[model samples]
Target: MSDLVAEHRTRSSDWRSRPVTWLVGTGFALAVLSLVGVGLLVVRADRAGQPAFAFLQWNLFLAWIPFVLATCLAAVHHRRGPRPLLWALGGAWLLFLPNAPYILTDFIHLGRRDGAPLWFDAALIGTFAATGLILGLASLLIVHHVVEARSGRVVGWVVAVGSLVLSALGVYLGRFPRFNSWDVITDPNGLIAVVLERLADPLGNPFLLRFGLLMSVLLLGCYLVAWVLGRGILGPLNGRVTR
Candidate 1:
């Protein structure tokens, strides 16, 4: 019993000394705040006698999946380098990565309902969107570092940019066709058909182009801001971890 306790304490102490601890702690704190915001929305809905914005809860839950995956991938990569397990985790992470930022498009529901005040709904949605965006960016950064460690700096950045581009398309598909990440596995043919039909007529479906471009630009700007802020704040700690 004493040996087990001592081992647990030693492991905890070791984790605290690592930079990823800070990231994980911050992510957890933000997740709690997001959950609180969702709870408040639920309370408001209860009072209003209608189910308004309940979907936010599920959306926020989906948003966390990628962050969790990225954290797991980071831990695996740290322990085992670029092994097959790491690649499998990476694939799953990328598949769900867009979900984190997909909440931003929820702003379209800003004034669509009446159970809650416009201001309150705006604040609630904004809170979830911001939380989701931060989680997404943080995960991307984690993956970026892993890629950089494996490949060169140039390739790392290329992967990062490519991820953003793909995520933008993902957001579009989710918003328009309402395809879930699982659909890729459960209904690949249907998903592919929708994608092809949408792409086959660019002029007829200008909205797809417009939406994708807007989202890509928005994601890129937000990511750049996040990267700069993260570097400014965690530069020394990050250096220590990477070393």
Candidate 2:
């Protein structure tokens, strides 16, 4: 009986030591929390006798796309190195990356509803926004690792900063012009035209300039915090797994 117990303990220890175990467990927890946020929206809708913030579900779904892509990209890079497939996944991931942070702009709808109290609505939006931002930051970290592994730390930081800048622009275009990620493919000319029109007269588009700068700064600050905290939290687990 003692031998069996010892063997069981060994098996459990081995399971806990695997990085994949941690990855899957963390993903599962995030998914559960995302569902809980969706549930809150549903409860709000039912109580209000209308579908309030129903779009959050769709937005959250969009936010998950880049996260899923990042997870796949990380797994592929770990197993196969920088293959063409990894680059392809990386490109797709970048396109949808803005969607994750875009949920933050949904706050513009906070007082647009009637039935739900302001506090409840604020909480509902806050839950979704927080989840989306976390998803975005988590995905960014995974891709950052891939870049750092491929090039050097300097190149990694450059790519990360550039990605955040583009993500900020993407969020602006998404909120103001209402262009989806797929527009880059479907409405390339139109998208280019709008961007050029705005760029042609930066002074005339003060709002664009202001929003871009503010959002870029906000994203950069958030990413920096996530990077430092993530390293501190995961460093021990990583050391144990590597050892």
Candidate 3:
């Protein structure tokens, strides 16, 4: 265990001490990866007749470029935080919960645009929201951990604040009705009487379920994958465990 740990540190040290050229090169590479993810998600969803929101949500949520860059910074910097990791893991679990209803629905061919039991529909919307809220919290933690691990204290704080602001904005948009969204955001299920309708439709509003499955997949699918990758891969890349 000691030797394994030593080897890990060596790699971390090597990367941190590498030339500026390597750092810049790697940053560019990660940027390309980010672009590819966004582009691919968009192209695939569009081809599937999905809404632009799918592409927007996936690309916006994945945030791979910033994630990888922050990981690299964390590796070369402080590299220690208990709360950040806890927030991330816990948030990931919450984000995953929303999918339960979807899973049950699909399992029994009950997840539909038509309608179902009052309780069931409420569960579905609740879960979808839970998933988003959890992921947003997770993103904030991931950013915090990565930035805190890095050297630029001011930059790190900026990143953290920016993440919080973004999450807040997302919640606002999700909850508040928009004047521009009159054509969208209808109510299919209204048990809570508190959940604002969405500004986009999956099967009822503008486009019939021509791609409900695809749209749902785009939102939930990319979100889960990004969450896992950010926490698992990017988190550890910081390469530091303070003693």
Candidate 4:
């Protein structure tokens, strides 16, 4: 027990020493800002007697669920030897991962409003969606780093590609069928059955296939851009940061 505790402390110390900690901190601050921005939008809408955050409140909540989960998992993954715990956290992270990027779909709600100008609504949705996307990228990078450290580069790439594909499908389920991540826990068999049924006839479900494919591409592209920009920003500190 003493040795286990000591090892955990060492791992925690090592995790805190990494450069990526700053990135995580920045992402969290941005997430808080996004939430605050939405809250202001809701207040403004209410003051104007508009619908006032009927759908966006729920969507933003869902987006934050995955961000918080992934952030927790990122911190936990840095510790060694609790393989089962890591697996459980990783599974949960993947399950809710789609919700982060799912905010992009909220753009469909953008339009003229009673009190707010069209640009205001557009900016509001854009900020939330952009923050969600950044959150997704940050979370994904943390998970990828963890996997790469434990596994190898090839396996890490596999996990990345697989996550993109699966997340795309998850987004489809959430957007069209109105399924939530908890459905997997609440209705495991039903969710599995629906997923299997859909997989069995992927061709028949054209919308699902197309949407999933398109979203996957978009996610991959956005991830690459975010990664490059992050690297560029952190490049100056690379000599001081541990690989």
Q: All candidates' lDDT scores? A: 0.83, 0.85, 0.40, 0.74
**Model 1: per-residue Cα lDDT over 150-202, one tens digit each:** 66678878989999999999998899899999999999999999988877887
The digit string of per-residue lDDT tens for model 4 on 1-243 reads 999999988966655565465656776787687777677677667777766546666776766665566667656654443777778888988988888898889877776456777777777777778777777777777676667666766776789779878888888888887888999989888888888898798799888778988999999998878667755554422112123
lDDT by residue (69-144, candidate 2, tens digit) is 9989878866755468878998999999999999999999999999988999999999999889989998888788
Clashing pairs in 4: none
User: Predictions ranked by TM-score, top down?
Assistant: 2, 1, 4, 3
Clashes of each: 0, 0, 1, 0
- In model 3, pairs of residues that clash are 75-238
User: At residue 29, what lDDT does model 2 achieve?
Assistant: 74
Model 1: pairs clashing at backbone N, Cα or C within 3 Å: none
| Tens-digit lDDT string for candidate 3 (105-219) | 2222224323344454344434333433433334344455544554344664565444443333233323233211112235423412323333343234443232334444444
lDDT of 2 at 211: 98
Please identify model 2 stretches exceeding 4 Å from their true place: 1-22, 236-243
Q: Please report the TM-score between candidate 1 and the true structure.
A: 0.85
Q: How well does each candidate superpose onto the true structure, as a TM-score?
A: 0.85, 0.87, 0.30, 0.81
Score candidate 2 by TM-score against the native. 0.87
**Model 1 spans with C-alpha error above 4 angstroms:** 1-18, 202-204, 236-243
> For candidate 2, what's the RMSD?
5.4
